[model samples]
Target chain A: MAGGTEIVAHRSGIEKAVAGLILVACAFYCFHALGLNFGSLSNPRSGFMPSVIGVSATVLAAVNLVLTLRKHRMAEADEVALDRYTALNLLMALAGTIAFLVLLDLAGYVVASALYLLFLTKLTRSPGWLVPMAVSIGATGFFYFCFVMLLGVTLP
Target chain B: MENFALLMQGFQASLALHNILAALAGVTLGTLAGVLPGIGISGTIALLLPISFGMEPLTALIMFSGIYYGAMYGGSITSILVNVPGEGASVVTMIEGYQMARRGRAGAALAIAAIGSFVAGTLGVVGITFIAPPLAQVAIAFGPPEYFAIAALGLLVLTNLSGGSALRAVLMMLIGLMLGTVGMDYMTGLVRFGFGVDGLGDGLDFIVIVMGVFGLGEVLARICERQNDVRVTKIKFKDLYPNREETRRSILPIFRGGLIGAIMGLIPGPSGTISTFASYALEKKLSTRREEWGKGAIEGVAGPEAANNAASSFTMIPLLSLGLPFSASAALLLSGFMIHGIQPGPMLVSTEPVLFWGLIASMYIGNLICLILNLPLVGLFASVLRAPMRYLMPVVALVTFTGAYVLNYSLFDLGVLTFFGFLGFFLQMSGYSLAPLALGAFLGPQLEQGLIQTMVLTDGNIWTLMTRPLAGTALWLGVAMIGWMIFRFIRQLLRRSSSQPVAEDV
Candidate 1:
């Protein structure tokens, strides 16, 4: 019988390989922690439903691995060269998020937000100091007006 | 007669200057974020949600709706100008829209979209004004069992929309149901899925998950795939509006699109995306000039764009009448009602008729504002597409962080945002369509609740769903949907299998 069809840069083998391994490891851990057997409708248990989830997840993971082996091969994605700069950009984006959080805790929302905006503006190779500075301030002021003044949501 | 007078008063109230300005602000901000890659409407709404907290409930809701519709419009911009369709519905538009752009008909394509959105949105508002109260009367009589039935029907509707992959959709829906189980149990209020984290006590914020999956994940995937320069040329001025002939050809599609949108909007669930996709598929299939489709056929852009906006307006019907929020935008608006300490249901009709009818009436006002602002600002919007990737990424990241943080003023929110963002990114990178995943997230909880309720009401006899007429019809409909999907799947497999030998033989 025919299985899954071919797709361009389709992720079958690699995804299954990775997700399968994680599923196996995670499912076992989850099973050990949470028991199966959610009691009858009269009495539901905490670990009851989770046991099914954990066990089923493990089985699904194993099934996925088999499907990957049968339906796909690594060579399908070989034509494409994985670019490096893309990875770097993603990392920068993630790191920037980390920094923004740290800054939010240290400074108030306005100051930290302004600084982060300026930094982001610079990444675009945005010309001129005025635009970024003006934007940063405007963003900060806007947030202050919206969060602090209106919603009664206290933003530090 | 007094009711008519009250309705008129609410309608006039929506036309006020402040409400107009608020709607303008929302759509403008929404378009900016929605047009941008990785900045989805949900994310923009979530980011702006904290700000909405401080505004008057009406102002907050108008702005929120603007953002929702604006994102729909904005999403089409990138899809047409570039090949990236920020949302799934835009994928259909992208087929014909970007093709039109590449051929340098971007202006006409965009013009059709704007006009179509206006026509549909206006009609949808009209529909809501007349239909909502009657629907509310029915909804008022609904018990928990009825709600369970509605949710079950929504799942059935979703199954038909799995883009032909029913199995994957079912699996995804189940996963969403499981994830929805993670917070404190609704009945028991018992802690679940806390993972020892205090933040998990309340469960993952729905908005947070949407942003991570739709906003941050999209950016991450783009970064991974587009390490090299990935800019597309911006659409120029002359190409902005469709010619007379194009407009003539598009009229019927626009009307049909509006009707579809209005109807879809009143439904419970993520009908915005579903409606748009359905319209585009229908439009493409019906268009006399089918070959023009995916070649940036103006109808492709017009139909879906109109549908999304119409749905946005009509969604207010159920929210105003029954206080039902099937989609995120409606939920956001529903939250507005709660903030004012006014529950939005049957009582909202009599109790807060002003707020209820005012918002509905304001939709007409909002439609006018959208036309005035959006069309004139197309050129300016084009410039946004030219923004370099580096700057866009960090801004999106920071916005994600700040938006999450401001919501709870907790550092833990940031952690939740980033972690989910990564998970979202991974899901995208792995080729699992996020649309189904997100749709499942929105629908799963409600479906589970419905299933449980239906089961309970039936007294442990799972077959009672078929015994009750309305609920049974819905159950049968759900089964039919699954069966149809299975049939489609088999057909697809056969088509693929049949075609394979030809390729090898060649």
Candidate 2:
């Protein structure tokens, strides 16, 4: 029960943080949209729709953040603990994808994709290195044949 | 008689050798997508949109239609066998279907679902054949005000019905609309939020955002969970038939559910999922053996499965006739159509009668193909569940990367994909629905165009714009929907506050 409470508290914290981030995004969007041409309603310009949407979103996000804070207060702020395993797994996958992007520029599609798959398969705790290696290489080859050879898609 | 002749012409076109092969490949891939838990119909269609660039528009559309309904058939397999629904529509089936699986009546449940899907799906095609032409005729009269009203109503109804906090759904939708404004303004040709990036000149690609959110985001979410082997229920070939009593019981429910779905599908919301739940409730009420519902009633499996398939077929009417997508999957299908340089709307019937009628005709063939494929191949499809996630997720991630890169060969698009992927993951985690976001992005331009055109036509008098009959009714409906959401929201807050003191005291 205590562990469950802690998890809920941690989730509440994350929710509040997300709400805050969205609110900030909405603000930035509004500011950026305002800088563009705000043509009159009779003949609305490019920025008109964005400005309207940004303002509405900013208001809604603010309300969401307030509601989240109120809910957090109502819950009495139990002990906060993160799900480290899930977090770490998500981080690894994201980092690996970003690394793939960089490597695709530095190396090439073949090497970057193969390494990305290898890293992800291992991260998923495939039985051993051999299986991950085989799966990654085999899958990369299939993708290459399908995309490049058959579909005539050029890959860098 | 003219419609009949046109439909016959459609049959002739769809029966061509290549179209048949296209339909075959589509259903097969669609089934695979439905069986796989990680990716869904939206992701699959989005992935294939780029690949379909080279095919004839008719062939690509035929294939997409096959995938659309084939997925409905395939989703039931996982729900019944492994107790995990492959998609949202199959969730209802998992209840009694999984229970039936536990009782070793899995074969009967599977057989009934396939039969029901085929019957309802065919019925939906017949409905579309007669109804969509007239609907398109009526839609041709719609002007800017009406279009704006319909689009606003769609966004409102979807966010209201998208199964979360209405505020969160609206927020996601607004954000999507903002994203839609990032590229060139069609009316003015001015880039609103380009941030000096050359890639923003054409605007954010819809397929790229969809791939990131649905494909890569789903993979990220799945890999974060602990990998566990799924236990699939085994069935012999001989056990595949439903017995006499079960077969008789399912017939009425199948028809009843099909009618319910055909009607619901016309509404602008998640009709596929909603219709299944509605059918289940209706069947529960109508069943004499109500006690068997939660336990392994064959009717429970038959009705919802039929309803979802029927709903999937009927949902295409709006997309085909009005060029508006009410659901996420339909939106993706609309994107597929646009990618092939085919715009589906009122003029489509007159301008591209062959493609329109051919696609409709292909649905009939596709539904028949799904029925034939699902029955004998259930075992093979069920085997897909046994494939470990460790091997599958990496492959999915790689495909997403490759597909995104191939779209424009732009590395900037890949960056956009990754950004949206992460954004989608976090937003989903925070309890925001992505359907409205996708739908909003898709509809944003249409909505803005309609509003601008109407304003200019009415000389900036928004009231005159609202006074038009069809537009007025649609706008009123949107307002009523908003009022209902607010009422529900306040009631929930009040209930929560009332309950809080009791919890504290306890």
Candidate 3:
């Protein structure tokens, strides 16, 4: 129970930290926006809307942060177990896509796409490795045929 | 009478062999896509957009319209049978529809939903066919201030009614607006926030951002959660029709839901979802079998499903008449129109009568097709719901990436897509709705252009915007809506504080 509470606290802390990062981003946006020329109201300039948006975003983020913190402070922490296995899989999924994007630029589209699919299918652990492999091959072949052969997408 | 003649011509154009084939293919693919959990109509359309690129404008549009109705049909199947809403609008259906399924009334529930959708969808198309032209005529007289007011109301209404904290929704919208400002300022020809990056100069691609935020974000979110097993009852064709009693119970709800949905559709925000909720609430209040609502009631399934379908069709009004997209799906359709080199607005009716009326006529055909396709194929689509997320998510991710890539073929655009995907996931995790953000991204430029144009015309008198009759009324209504939302939010917060101190879920 103590460990659960600690985990809840940790998650809350992460939330607050992210909220703080939003504030920082808004601040940076405002600062950067100031460099652009802000013309008069009748004749708006490049920075007019950006500056307004940045300030508004900053204020709203601040209010949300305060409300969140107050709510957190007022309540007893109840932990929901974070599914680390799924989380890791999700992370790997993200990594796999990023890798695919890079490899698509380096290797050809088919090779990169097939590899990405194989990796994702293995992670799924569905009917079996063979089925997934066949599915992956089929998916790639279909996409290639439809997009490149038929439509002439000129995919790199 | 002229409109009728034009519509007849449109039907003539649309009934061609190839167009019919395109519509059939679109609805089939759309229904299947909708059956697949987590892939919504917007995401599905975005994924399939590349394929439509080579086709003629009318043919492609007919296909898209088909997909729109078909996807709605597909969503209700999952919501009823599996208790997993395929998209936002079908969430209400899951409540009582799932219960009915559990009670061995899945067939009746599914049939009622399908029939209700067909009726409501056809009614909505009828409304659109008649109402849109006159609305466009009124819109033709609108000035920059009017545009500004309408755009503002659309954004404000969307944010307020997005089923979240108004403050958070507004913040997300502001962020989206800021992101929308990331490219060249067309007024002064000055780049605002590109920061010397070559790719940023042209601005972010709407499709890429949509694919990332909606498509990839949903996939990632699902992947991060533990998978749950879902069971759908095997349904035979003989069990497809509702009994006489069930049909009798459903009639009033379907009509009432359709009316409510059509009315809600005229306003922006999450109209489809909002209409379903409104229908459910109204039906529950008026139902003789009110006690049977959460347990399982024909009215419950009938009303919301009808409302959702009706709203989905009529929500295209603002887009067709006023050149404003009220929702993300409308925004995608707007992008589609643009891709075809056709601007959809008041001028659309006159300038491109064929495209305009053809698209409208296609809706009627599409609804009929959905009814025909869904009735027998609900079983097949229900089977699709059982596909593992592990296999599904990866394909979804690939489609999103490829869709984003095909838009501009820029690596920098890919980076923007990835950034927005991560940002969208985090924002959703924090309980912020994405609809407002997408709306802001869509309406931001229109709002800015209107403001600037109004200012130029009025010589800096912002007060003049409030002087125009229609524009002023809309602007004031938007303000009042926001004020009411803020007040309600405060009251809810106070009540929560006074009652039970709850942990911040984020």
Candidate 4:
């Protein structure tokens, strides 16, 4: 029973955090939209739609936040929120992706992609070094042939 | 008769060697994507959108349509053999299908699903051939006000039906609309929210967001999941044919499911998934072999499978006629058309007759190809499930990154892709539906454009804009939907409160 309570709390906590984030984002968007031109109703300018969207979103977010605080049932999370290990997996994958981007700029597609693939394969717990290495190299080669050789895309 | 003649011309056009090859490749790739649980039709199409850049618009669209139809067939394979639904629409199929598989009728389940998909899909195409032209003809009469009202009604109906809090869907949609505003203001030639970034000048590319959210976002989500060993049921090629009893039973359900799907597909919000559930319930209720339900009933598999495919075909009606996409996959298809400098709507029938009719005609061929491929190649496709996610995810990530780069050859776009990929992952984790966001971003400009045009036409008298007949009806419908949602919410709250006291007393 305590475990069930803990799970519900954790779920609600995530929902509240998401609602808060949305509220902040919408507020910022509304502020930015306000800085743009506000033309007349008949002949609106560039900022008209943004302003309307931003303000409406801000209001909606605020309502959502209130609903969350009141413990009213809102949108139930479709998938389970990340646990500690899964969160770690996500962070590692994200870091690997960012690193791949940096590497691509410094090196080339083949080198960057190969290294990224190797890291990801290992991150997903590929048994040993041999399989990850083979997959990374083979996949990079296939991509090179498909994109550059066949499609004539100049990959950075 | 004229429409038939045009359809004949379309058949001639689609019969080209290149178009046939495109159809073949699309269905094959789509089936493979469907068999793999990690990716879906949206991700596959997003990943391949860049590749389609070099092809002619007709060929590209034909391939996309083929992929759409093929995924339907492929999704059933995983559901039957592994008890894992490959897509949302196949969930019901897994109930009876896996049971059948366990009873050594896996081949029959798969065969029935394929045949049902083919029959329903062809029916849907025939419906499109007859119904869509007339729908487009009517849509051609819509003014800016009516367009605005239609867009508004679509978003409202979708939010209500999208299976979550209406508030959450609306919020996501607003965010998407805000994102759509990032680029240049088309009418004024003034940039609204560029943030002084050079990439912001042209606004965010729809395909980039799609690839990031559907492709990379999916990968990120999958990585966090605990990998389970998938056990595939082996099938003898000889057992692929359904017995006479099974075949006879499936026939009516297939036609009935197809009819349900064809009608529901014309509505908004995940019609394919909805229609399948509806079909499943109806079949169970109407079945003579009621005791077999939830066991190894062939009708259970046949009905929902047909409904989903038929629904998929029907979903194209709104997109092809009104230039509106009611679902995520349809939105991707719309992007495919847009990328080719084509807009699908009333004007398309007149302006791009060959392309319009050709796409419709190609569905016939695509459905045939899917049926043929699914039967003989079931073993080959099912083997894809055995590939470990550890190796597969990396390839997906690399392809995503590579595809993002090829779009504009800009590092900025890659950065945007990464940003949205993470954003999508987090948003999905929070239980936000990404479909509304995708549709919002896609429709934001059109919605804004319509609003502005209506305002201009009505000379700032907004009420006058609503006074227009078609526009008035659509707006009223949206209002009624919102009212209904509020009433339902209040009723639920009251019921919960009442139930709580009874529970405490007990």
Q: Is candidate 2 or candidate 3 better by DockQ?
A: 3
Model 4 chain B weakest lDDT span, ten residues long: B497-506
lDDT of 3 at B419: 79
Angstrom error at residue B355, model 2 = 0.6
DockQ of 1: 0.25
| DockQ class, candidate 4 | acceptable
**Colliding residue pairs in candidate 4:** B183-B203
DockQ of 3: 0.53
lDDT of all predictions, in order shown?
0.66, 0.85, 0.82, 0.85
Q: How is the predicted docking of candidate 2 categorized under the CAPRI scheme? A: acceptable
lDDT of 3 by residue, B40-109 (tens): 7777777667667678899989998888888888888888888888888989999999999989889888
Off by over 4 Å in 2: A1-9, A76-82, B494-506
Worst 10 residues of 2 chain B by lDDT: B497-506
Could you tell me how far off, in angstroms, the CA of residue A45 lies in candidate 2 after the best superposition? 1.6
Cα-based TM-score, every candidate: 0.82, 0.96, 0.95, 0.95
lDDT of 2 by residue, B1-506 (tens): 98889999999999999999988888887887778785667877776666665689999988988788677767888899988887778899999999999999999999999999999999999998999999999999999899899889989988877776788899988988887887888887887778899998889988899898887788888776668998999988899999999999999999999999998888877888899999999999998998788998988999998998888889889888899999888999998888789999988998999989998999999998888877998898888888898788778778888888887899889989998888878776766789888988889889999988988888788888667899998988888888998898788778877785321110
Point out the higher-scoring one by TM-score: 1 or 3.
Answer: 3
Candidate 1 falls in which docking quality class? acceptable
